[model samples]
Target chain A: MNIRIENLTKSYGDQKAVDSISFEVKTGEVLGFLGPNGAGKSTTMKMITHYLNIDAGNITIDGRSVRNTDMKKHIGYLPEHNPLYEDMPVIDYLRFVAELQGVDAVKLDDRVKDMVRLCGLNDEKHKKINELSKGYRQRVGLAQAMIHDPEILILDEPTTGLDPNQIVEIRELIRTLGNSKTVILSTHILPEVEATCDRILIINKGKIVADGTAETLRKTASGSQVLRVKIQAPSQDEVKESVSQLAGVALVEKVEGSENRLEIQSHVDQNVNEAIFRLCVDKNWVLTEMVPFETKLEDIFRDLTMN
Target chain B: MKTSNATWIIAKRELSAFFNSLVAYILLISFLGFTGFFTWLSGNGDVFFRKQADLKVFFMIANWTLFFFIPAVTMRLLAEEKRSGTIELLLTKNVSDRQMVLGKYLSAFLMVLIALAFTIPYYLSVSQLGNFDHGATLSGYLGLILLSSAYIGIGLFASSLTNNQIVAFLLALLLGICFQFIFGVLANGSTGWISELFNTLSLTSHFDSISRGVIDSKDVVYFLSITFLGIFLSEYIISKRK
Candidate 1:
């Protein structure tokens, strides 16, 4: 199902937990929610699930307002911290969630079996949730959220406590599910967004700061490019001076305590790679290494979220 | 899911949770032990002392035991869910706030029913000794069930108001004491409209009338309204986040 949120606002006493923020998630897309702690990502997801009422504006699922319709049946939610009934066995908990989601009696058993297989909980199905490891418990949380095969999945930090292999497996699973369902997952892992999400939304202080694919967000983050080069020249000072004088090269400085390394920063919309290569060849200096530094998502996130 | 179906599903899970933990067994054993002692073994209200075939002493002891027991059953219903953040998971399902409240209320009510069911042996033993007032005894059991419902309702309301089980228990008992005895005591000590109002509000007066084979609609309505108000207030508090 498609989700459209418009001018949604919420407050706690004098503080606005979620301002008039708006966004949309299309069907068959995975949107990664990125924000620092207390950035309102969870608040927005809660509002989408209708767990929290929108103080202002509204959310619509496939053109129907959530306030006017019981959209919960169509949306599967994994709350933050992934709370589960620790006293119940994993299988029983999954069945209970499926029943609460209104899975039909005739197919409930089949659905529960499917979730067990899908979430890789077959070995631990009979054990109580609290007896399992944190990674296994996380899998149980994911299993219950998808037990009824909901059209939309809203997961708050889905891979918080998983190992590397499990994280990769879950990302693959989410990617597969995204082909036929709308998935909105929030996380502190920067690479997880690029690995799983079709779009990235960065919100800060209850407002949206950036929205687009990872590539587009990086492209808009900065106007200039930086490159580090190691040249076998007579002197580091000579290399820095020559690189600084080259056209399109805005700044050049000798690498701190390095004998032959220099950092070159290019002007906006400029390419200094070819110019540096030619200068090296002309001056009889051997260019041993040159690496272009692309803007990292971490830097972009920090730049956008940090004041 | 249908409204009632969601409610039942939640209630079923809660019921199973109660059984899977030690709480249910502890409550049953203690409740039976306490009531069993005072009804047949105690010197004051024992069947031998009363010299009556009816279970009046049993009913009176049950009223007091259940007043304390219902809160224990209900204190963890909402408070634990809030503390562990499971309330968010449950509420986000295809269940409405009213369904959630009613489902929890049903679980505690069923618990009280189960506890009461275990006392049937005491009734059976008393009846075998002599001719029992079956009409009055039956109404007395009905009155106990209705009174337990009112206490469970109030207990659930108290549970919904906070995330601590201890606080919920204390608050439920505090609220329950007013109806259990304070109002009745005040009515006896006062006069005029104040006494009349306290008398009407006191739960013991209605329970007494029903246990005596006086099945008045006024008494039934009184118990039903208190239960409804408690359940209604719980729903209102839970949905207040909206």
Candidate 2:
């Protein structure tokens, strides 16, 4: 269930909702799609699932074009907003999805029951979807998406309205599901990607700005490493001057609170901790604390998208 | 699964949804109440006073009632699906666009048939009243079914045009009125090919011919063609929106 999207483009009237962007997700790999609102994440997922027409380019699943109906049989899609029949009971809705997915008649009931168990809907199986809480409704959406045991699952903002506990539950469920299926989940929650995805693609204004593992994206977007040092030094200017003269130190600034504290910026590939300690020893400054600052995913996301 | 099987599965789910809600009961009761009140309780040619064995009065009232009632059954078919965003889930299934349209069309059509079936008591009671024209009564029922089918098609097409149920209802009613009476009125005042064309397109003319106990293929074709055209247009609209 490999997905290959090549130069895909979609336009609504004069506005291009999805520009010519391309990526691939191999089987058993979890690809996280990260973007702000209206960043074309859902549009891309829709095109891959064949729910929307590919306007300018092509998408293929396992080397076959998605235009073929057979390609849809292997792909499961939970669209944005996670729409379900409000009047239908959870079990009935799952069964209906299974039937539509072309599950064999002999295995249909078992498959639906498995989804109910997997999605933790056993307690609410008989309740109408409208009666359930938002979190349970999301569970039902996920259950229906996997009823036929599809090889690929495309979920858009799957955990949008869930509470904290529900989010963790679903996060674990997605991680487990990713063990054997190719999953492309889109969300604004960065930690969800760090927790579940093997790779992350950050799209901004219909273009891929960053694609890599979480660590790589952090390093790439950060451009440099920061080191925070607190010591019993002589003065702010003296510490700044000594730290700035280090080989890999790019910039040095005084910490506002105390004259003894200095913030050091170094080259991207440099680890200034050892060099700073030696400088401190040479300057006879008793270094109380030296900590390297790692850029948070939130900062990276903001830096990538805000500009 | 086969496309037909998928269609049936979708149709069954739709029918179940209809029955589970209050809309179906409200529609059935109101439709029967209106038909019953008009046929036996109101109007100059009431069944009891007219003393006619035929159900011409019943058919006439039914023809008008369905013009409004059929839209109620169909207005939410596609419109609500679109509003609720379930149309995305439905289209992503292994189901084809045509299958999805037909599935919804059949469910609404079946509800109409059930409403029509409730009038059997009227038929039976009328049969016992006098020497009834059974052939004409049968033809009348056939005509109603065909006419209902045509209206259902139009209603489905209207539902696809917008996500607002009220708008869908009004659009279907507008189209139904045009085919049911406006065209006939225009035909009566015109002459030559224009009149003939309007006359042929009018639903009432074909319905009248079928109600006269003559099942002409041309009349049947006319009704079938309109029904097909409506469903076909709905399918096209759904695909285009995709």
Candidate 3:
């Protein structure tokens, strides 16, 4: 299913939680929603899943408004905290969710088994949810969300409490699910977005500040390339003088308190690495290290959100 | 699936949760124990002392017991879900707010029924001792069920108003007390139209009318209206929150 949100707005008292924002997610696409705390990421997901009413504008799944109950059947949501009945056994909880999702009684057993297997809850399936580790509990949450084979899944901070190993496990699970489903995952984890999302949307203060592939967002945020070169030479001034003269080099500066290090900034459209390498060889400066700096998603996120 | 099916599914889940938790056992034991002790063992009107085949004393004790017990059963129905954040999961399901409210309400009502069902042994033991007024017994059970239904509705509405279980319990109790006895007490002091209005609004008045083995349409309508009003207001609040 494809989701189209148009001019959506939600306000709590005098504060606007989600401003007039609009975006769309196509079928089989994994869209990552990134934002700081209280940036309306959860609010947007809630509106899409029809958990909260839209204050203004519209959200449609495959041309049907989200307010329609029929539309909810096709969308699955894991809320911010991944709430579950702690007293219920994992399988029982999954079955309960499946029943609510309208899974046929005849297929219920097989569907629940499939979810248990898919979410890697095979061992902990019989354990009460409260007794399971946080990682396993999150798996249960995921299982419930996908129990009915929803075409679209919306997960808010799905990896909030998981350890590194558990995070990777869930990331892989989400990636596998994304092959046949349209997945919208919201998280503050930059690596999760870079690892799983086909597209990224950075929302800050109820507005979309950046939207594109991770690479594109990074490039757009940092329009220029940076290179840090450390040379075993006589002085830093010599390295800066030679590198600064290159045609593509935008700026060159000496590393503070380091006579052997020079920082080079290059124009966005230029490949200055080769020029620097040639300059080092021609000037006979022993080049020890020349590393290109790629702007990370973290930098891009901070740049968009902090301002 | 049909909408009613969704409501039933939710109701089933809620009932299971109730039965599986410690609260269910605690409520059942304490309710049965308190009522049993009062009806069969305590006071001059105790069953053995009266030597009557009727359960008037039992019904009176039950009414008082349920005023507190029913709220305890219902306090966590919606409030705990809201506090634990499971309400989001519930509301986002393919179920409507009305279905959610009814599903939860029915679960609490069923629990009250089960508790009331346990008191049947009292009626049985009394019937064996002498000629029993079966009509009064039947009417008394109906009145208790209807009264419990009213409390369930009020409790559910209270639960929906807040996420704190204790607060919900107190709120429901306060509302139940007003409808149960306070209105009737006030009605006695007032006169004419005001007295009649208070009497009509008092839950005990309708309960008394039904307990007399005369199923008055006006009394039944009064209890049903209160039940509907409470459930309707709860649904309204849930929808407004969304």
Candidate 4:
């Protein structure tokens, strides 16, 4: 029903590919594993699936140790590569996976059929896998993983090679799947995590450094907000100086333009909007535009990881 | 689930690939052609063929025929999956390393059996012409099954070792031929533990005994060793790949 890891570490020689990191995903909960390249997201998924031996630590799935064969029965994993038997037909491939997961012969056909329908691969079910497009191939990979209806689904970079449209479709699929399955998915795309996950785990240097809802993390990570203001006056240097003197204004810099614009940076604990509006009115500086930058997940990710 | 179901699933896919592929057909036809030519050439000339069908001659020629084709057929078993990045999907699907290796091995091994079955017409023609050693013919086919399976196992192991199908093919060939011949040759020049070891490993010698219509326990063990060793190695390589 859930996954829990305690002080998990995986080292390749001296480098800790997956440093001591721990987090949990509740049943029917979607946890976005966010990280830049080499942050050990895939390594973490691999360790959880028992595909890679942990250098140190313990991991459990739904209260059962990941090492137990019983736990394997309840798990489904899609590796980042989307590797498959290209020479086989799509349906044949699914049936093979189903049998491996111990699906009974009587139910195997129905199981494969359900996956094919869910992944939208019905049209290409009989075609040779080698002939499918990248999107279709990814669909096949998804179908195979879900054919057994596992409780825990660990997907690593599921959208890496997909196009924009396919990315959206797959994202939609994951969201639906997440509603009924415990999902731990790793992706570097910031918007994707925001769109599909309930909670976010941001990993940096192989360790999870931040874990929270996307909105909450963005609130704290964006220590200061920038308001791009445009005024009617030819020169807004007077307005800029006035805004800089405001109580919450951290910095006020003039943007090069006869358009009368300034980029206002703010500090925590203060809203500088009131002071900026007062200054503009007092100076009779016609405020053409006042746009406050909303907190973006990309900004939060960069702030946490790129340091 | 019982392991055989997993094995059957893999075997079905593998066997379909074998039949669907031009390579399997090419190998089968070439095998029949070479063995047929050898059987014709030995007619009325070899002692056994003077009164009966030259099945020993047929099986002996089969050894050479498979050397070229079996490697080609089995090369892509595991190697292609690795190359195309499908091995990951296979493992996470609840298939153990043993099931994966055995399933593929069973698939390729079945191809050899089917191709051998196609050669039944030759036996029919021989029986109509004269009295053949019926027992030897049956055992010869049995020896071929064991020998080809051993080759398939070796090829599967080689395939698992690399993602490149060509590399797997070459590796399978080298190992297959080594098992079939080198141990026999090496056993000749030495007279000690080394000689005994090589003798025990000699594939052709065991196969040759079966060619003469005699099923020896040591020979059976020899063939089984090669088959199991190859399969075990395939599992070892695949497990590390994860």
| Predicted model with the maximum lDDT | 1
lDDT by residue (tens digit), candidate 2, B50-158: 9887788888888898899999989998999999999999888888889999999999889989999999999999999898889989999999999899999999999
Candidate 2 DockQ vs. native: 0.85
Please list the residue runs of candidate 3 whose C-alpha ends up more than 4 Å from where it truly belongs after superposition: A256-259
Error of 4 at A223 (Å): 2.7
Best by TM-score: 1
- TM-score per model for chain B alone? 0.97, 0.96, 0.97, 0.92
Most DockQ-accurate candidate: 3
DockQ of 1: 0.82
What TM-score does prediction 3 earn?
Answer: 0.96
Clashes per candidate (backbone, < 3 Å): 0, 0, 0, 3
Worst-scoring 10-residue span by lDDT in model 1 chain A: A65-74
Q: How do these models rank on DockQ, best leading?
A: 3, 2, 1, 4
lDDT of 2 by residue, A153-243 (tens): 9999899889998899898888888989999999989899999899999999889989999999987877788888887876857777878
- Fnat of each prediction? 0.87, 0.93, 0.91, 0.67
**How many clashes would you count in candidate 2?**
0
lDDT of 4 at B237: 82
